[model samples]
Target: MTAAPGPSRIVRYAMAVAWSSFLSAGVLEALVFAVVDPHELRWFGAAPVELSAEALYTLSFLIFWGVVALGASLALALVNLPADEPKPQRGSPGWPR
Candidate 1:
């Protein structure tokens, strides 16, 4: 029989999903920013580098959603863990005895 995923594997899967959400959110925000106006902001403090107000706004939104998704997905992964799965051992018979 195949071995169930180990703790490290589950953690990796959770992290991968979290990072994927971060990247997907960033791309989505960029796409939305393309059609959005860049000057749609009130007077604000100096912006670091050459970023515009709209781009900064998009960045902030991306961070907020990304963190929220990461937390939710990680929690879901932890909560949905399989209960009492049988572990496969090395150099053993079909039953791993």
Candidate 2:
């Protein structure tokens, strides 16, 4: 029988998903901000509402991509989890002799 995934494997899988999500979200956010309001380029300033129709379209695209990337990464991470292991017999020592 296959061994269950240890804590390290779980953490590694989670990290992979987290990193991918972070990078994809950051890129998408940047693209949306750049297209929506080029003047509001301040990294720490409040967003401005001076966006054109083209800018809105671009922003929508960015959001779509972000959602897709997030979903894909989560799905991949979930798939990497180890399959269920057989439960130990009740009223017995935990490990097999």
Query: Which candidate leads in lDDT?
Result: 1
Which RMSD does model 1 reach against the true structure?
5.9
Backbone clash count for every predicted candidate, in the order shown = 0, 0
TM-score of 1: 0.47
TM-score of each: 0.47, 0.39
Worst 10 residues of 2 by lDDT: 35-44
lDDT of 2 by residue, 24-94 (tens): 76677667666655544434576655766567556656676668667976688566556667766667966
Which segments of model 1 are wrong by more than 4 Å? 1-7, 43-58, 61-79, 90-97
Best by TM-score: 1
lDDT score for candidate 2 against the true structure? 0.65
